[model samples]
Target: MRLLHSKTLEFATFYGDATPPYTILSHTWGDEEVTFEDMRFIQKRKSLPEDLRRSPEFMLAFDAAARLLFPPNRDPEKLAGYEKIRKTAEIANRRGHRYFWIDTCCIDKSSSSELQEAINSMYSWYKKSAICIVYLEDVDISFPAGTWELAPGHLTRFAASLKSSRWITRGWTLQELIAPGRLTFYNKDWEPMISKYVAAAAISSATKIPPYVLATGQLHRASVAQKMSWAAKRETTRTEDMAYCLLGLFQVHMPMLYGEGQHAFLRLQHEILQNSDDNTIFAWEPLSSPMLPSIYRGLLARSPEAFSSTSKHQVERSYFTTEAKEGIRVDLEKAPLVLPSGEVYYVAILGSANGTKLSFGDIHHLKQFYMFLKQLDEPNNGRRKQYVRVMGIPNNAQHQVQHNILIFHAETICVRQQPIIPLNFETTEFSRFVLRPDTYSATGLPDIQAMTVWPLGLISEKKEIMIPSHSKDFTALVWLQEHFNSSVSNVQVLLKFTRFPRVGYWCDIITGKQWPKDRDSVDEWRKAIERNHSVKELAQRKRYRIGTRSEIRTVSIEPGIHADQICLFVNIDGLII
Candidate 1:
């Protein structure tokens, strides 16, 4: 552990029991933070050549150099991040603490091992703090000390002040909120408004954390799903910090992989599952994109955001076990919904089934947690069949319940952190992308033909692209085709752009002539998917060999693509089937 001298603000390294009792500072990071390097520079500058120290006038003339040399010629307090450190140390010193810790300057983050160690031990560090000082620079309340009126709506002012506080909405601040039972919240002016104990109920209302949990710091009081729900709305500047920040809450530790992105959350869930038998960890349900689909996802969730509504959901841990390679196997409650094709989908009941409205819906019957799952054979792990989450199907239809003889059956399926196929990335940057045909190819095929694609539902995606939606839902239906052996034998492709909260760009390429009775595969698909009524008729217009069976092509969303960049890459050689 690293600490500052509180009086001198000089950094000192401590190990295990050698670490002294210190106060920890928790606050949202600024645009430019005072780093460990900055603290080291201040220390080194103190031993500067006596001549340079005496020549304050020379240093002031070169203002930039003065900042590097020492805090002079400019108010270091007004700079981006120094005032918080100085104030934190001042508070700690006044409180009779010898040392203090602040994330920006205490830990040498440049070293990977040191950073990892600090993060893994961060929870314990905060939990052991004599007092955790939370500085909400955005929260300003001019009301004098001891002026809080503890009435029904009286705390409104305090809550309103915290309404815009960046501290509550940050990923790292969550652990800082939970770990230290004895902590104080200071406003922008460094005025102590309330201790965490005094504002537990208000903080709970603001953060969706139970008041008791905030006051007592007993994590066991909340279920896994509830703990996960707290983090769902919090945002982390670094993508990986979303998962890393919750390490203390779950009492689990793992290596910090910065570039791993959402996979970091999956790894966190895996570690939590490994340490504890909490099946509600899988109870997260995404309020999915409105783009109609037969798209499927893996058993694991994409991110903590998916678990936002999981607070009310938790049940007995049922047959939950994770594996290094083979994936996790859990017994799920499978809904009886036979699809058009032989493809079987199971609307597995997720935990919170207590008539509480969740992501599924608020209707009486829709209160239970239901998520779509599709079972498949795992060739690597024998001829055994396992289930992956089915994405995009409407919730009402996906998990249909009737007073019929067929009830939910108990079935076991394997789940892993990795998604099944056509990995979906959650991003809002991709408002829309033009769907155009890419050059087709097959290894050693005689020839490949170029495809010309213009949207049939809308104008050429080139001109009419970036329109929010073609219909009621945020979806755009595009008509395209693939040429196989000859011009006569072609496959008609329908490219449906996902809704506003778009996942990776995907197109359900259902290539087949015959399908089950939703009445005739091609026509029913046309009628089935043309929901919210974007277009009426998409007739084949001529005879062509479409294919033998139905198949959906879900594509992974790549980052940094523009609306003009074509994402439709179709290989016609496979259409020969």
Candidate 2:
């Protein structure tokens, strides 16, 4: 470790227990800040080139050094880094500390190993310091402390300015704020502002960091998500440093990879998962972009912002288990079903809070289902009756037999309104609905509302049955098929039969002309529609030829039944025939 001599204005190296107590400067990096090279030149008594000495950063370092090294010859110019270092040394000297460390000049950043070591040890260094001097360059204060305190409405403005300081938003300063045992804030003119105790609440409200963690440095007491939320809005100059700066807060370390870009954060998440089994790490919601299908989205979160909501709640670690022996086990007798585009997914039975079972085949599908449930759960004039269940699956062979499964429950969404008929055939659960040939002209489209329906059920490895139903239910199912035409052919669709005011019958669209021949052949044809078919191909398929001779024209698929027939069926009372 490197420490700057408060009295001598010279740099000294210390290792292990030989290091003396030092005050550390915490401030945002400025473009003109001094560097280790500048300090070395100053220590060697070498004359800096005219241009170099004229630089704002070099001048600041020189002036600060002059103030401490020769007390009577301090410069009076208002410069960025000069006052911060000068006041910090003055405060440390008053407190009887002979050394202080400023990030810009203390360590040689040109050396990779030294830089890495410094970063990894920064938290401990700050924690063991005599005091952490926070320089809020953006905050302004009146010269006389008593007069400033006595000014009308100054305290409120001061608090607001302190809370909104650029010092708090820098990536490296996050650990500096949390890891220190004692900290004092100083305004631009080096006027004493407030202690960590006096400004705890305001800091907490501004940063979304808990007051307890700031006061006691008990970061381990907070869940991974809550800790991550502290750095959500914070930023670093280099993208990768966004993750590196957070190393101490998570108490996990990995080799620094500066050029890896955003993947650095992904690696951080990988390292975090290894040390802790908190599943809340996966509970982050994606920003802006449409949610990726579950299978395609990796375990890592894009940014700390994902945990913003989780941080607000008092998270309990007891909700997740680190021990494999305590994890919930899911068994899959078959390999994951493969889509035509080569993506693999599986179906898992999830138990709902109401004791009913629902099956979600893919993570993306589950997320979609949950989104609908959330909409239904939104509060209106009255409280909405809502139920939700989320269970985490350990990413291990023992907990996941053949496939990964995450189960959630919503009573208002998936509950069966009518008693299921006890049928003797195989049935599948589905949640998606689509409409095909999405456009139509009133003049050319048919008014044929009535249509024949064939309800096919997949039973065993070879047999299928055509279910017989009442004309009304059958017609309703056929009518429902038109509304689902836009859906991907491979998506299992749920069709609801309405009898005026009541939902009379509900069925799942199991298979059509392209249905797999058997269980063993399911994967060969279970390709996702968007993946297997191009936009042009889908568009071509949606068009219809109006006439043969001179009037041949392309039009959207006519409403009702076109050349492509519709098939639908429901399992009578969850029974398989």
Candidate 3:
């Protein structure tokens, strides 16, 4: 680490345990900031080259440094980067500290190893600092005389302005604000604005960072989501620095890759996952409105905006466990079925609804899950109670699946007005629905041929149901085809009769395809019944008028009934009888 002599303004490097107590400067970077090389030339009284002298940033630095060093005829106005550096040194000297560090001039960023070491150690450096001087360049310190004590109204306005300072929104300043033991804020004129102890509440409100963390520097007490929310609104000049700046907050380090773009954040999440098991890290929603068949669904959050509302919630790591053998596997389990064409399909089961619970609260939590449900094509209605099950195929096998499954508990939350306690349904099961290799197409719609639903357990009799692969109303079919589909396979299709909460359209038909042998018998029976006009007319009477509107007509057919006799029957004495 390099520290500047408070009185002499000469740079000196300190290593190991010999480093002296130093004050650090925390401020937003300006175009005219002094760099290590610039400081070296300034210290030797050497004239900068023509190009350097002509540069506005260099001129600004020269003027600010001249004002402090010569002071006798210095301009009162035109203060710039050097003024901040000078003010920091003067303040340190006044406090009897001989060494101080300014980011712009302290570390030589030209060296990659030095840059990486500085960043990885930045949080600790700030925490161990004797003091942190925060300069809010945009805040004005000129108030009416004697009102310096600050009337209640004036204080509120001052606090509000302080809260909105650009100093708090820079990516690098986040750690500087939280890591330092003692911090003092100053305005443009180098006048004291507020201290960490005095403005904790206002700072918390502005940054969404907890006051406790700011006060005690115990950031680990906050949840991962909460820590992420603090950076939700912060930004950096380089995209990757947004993640690099946060290394200290999470206390994890990795090689710095400047040009990696958004993958830097993904890497950060992977590193966090290795050291911590906080599932809430995955609990973020996209900032843009969610769409069904969403493109944003993934294991890592795209940005900090996803954790905007999670700052207030307390998350327990114990809520998640790796008890189930299937739980530990990162890959989705492929369905164990083969297409009639003798082709294999790859299935990837993303997430299931069986062990998960759902509830209604602030729209925030719904948005979080909705963000996770990016595979769906439509956004969930915020007003309704929603339950989502997410499933996906691995990228290698994604082309083999028609569409990923997004199973909602019901069509609308109002159908089950009473909140389902624990929200776990015995019949709910999630499985990957891989499409036949021959049938897979980029433009093809998802169908049941490529997907299958299985029962959660053997508590109840299960049956299988097949439908046309090109069906658009699969959500409705899954609900209405419950009984008929249940008798053939172990899968229980649980569908409830309810009005469409979003739109008033009603589902009328519960369609299913029987097994080959059973279908043949039904076809033969239908032909035998149609041979009689009386039986045919009775069967045609299944159509009914449901609503008051003349156009509202529905064809309601009860499954397992043919010619007014039960079509599906089992006799204890003789099964065929």
Model 1 lDDT per residue over 1-577, tens place = 8899888777888888888989999998986678777777667666567888679885555456656655554444445788888899899999999999999887888899999999999999999999999898887775555664344454677887786787878899899989996898887899887788988888888888889888899988687889989988899988999989899899998998888898898888878878877667767765655563344455567678888987766544545465645467765565545542223455566443322223322223643456666554444536335555656554444355332232455655675444332223332223444433233433333332223332333444252334342332233333334444554333334444443333334433333343234224455555555542444443212122345424333222232223212132322332221
- Model 3 quality (TM-score): 0.55
Clashing pairs in 1: 313-352, 504-557
Query: Which residue segments of model 2 deviate by more than 4 Å?
Result: 46-79, 142-155, 289-296, 313-577
What is the lDDT ranking, best to worst? 1, 3, 2
Q: Could you give candidate 2's per-residue lDDT for residues 1-577 as a string of tens digits?
A: 8898887777789999999999888988885566776566556543567787678998877667766754354222233555556677788898889999998878798899999898888888998898999888888864355564345565566668966788877889999999898987788777777777666776787888889887988876787778888888888999999999888888888888799998888778767867875555655655543321111123346678666666743333322222122122211111233322222333322222222233333444332112211111333464332212211211232223333333333222221111121222111111111133213333333222112222323122222222222222221122112212333212233234322332233333332333333333323433432233323212211222222313222212111111111122322211111
Cα lDDT tens digits, model 3, 1-577, are: 8899998888888987889999999999986677776676567644457788778988888777776654455332233777877899999998889999999988999899999999999998999999999888899855554554444564566668877788877999999999998998777888866678767777787888888888999976787888899898888999899899999999999999888998898788778877775656755655653222212133457677678877865554532322221112131222322223222222222323332333212222332222222111222354332222232213333334334332223121111111122211211111111111222223222112212332222112222232222232222122211112223211112221211221111222212333232224545533432342232122211322212323221222222211111111111110010
Q: Residue 201 error for model 1, in Å?
A: 0.8
Worst 10 residues of 1 by lDDT: 559-568
Estimate TM-scores for all models.
Answer: 0.70, 0.54, 0.55
Q: What is the lDDT of residue 216 in candidate 1?
A: 91
Off by over 4 Å in 1: 48-52, 55-78, 146-154, 324-326, 333-335, 339-344, 347-370, 377-381, 395-401, 416-455, 458-570, 573-577
Give the Å shift of residue 28 in candidate 1: 1.5
Candidate 3 Cα errors over 4 Å, as ranges = 46-79, 142-155, 291-296, 319-577
For candidate 2, what is the total of clashing residue pairs?
A: 16
Taken over the whole model, the C-alpha lDDT of each candidate is: 0.63, 0.53, 0.54
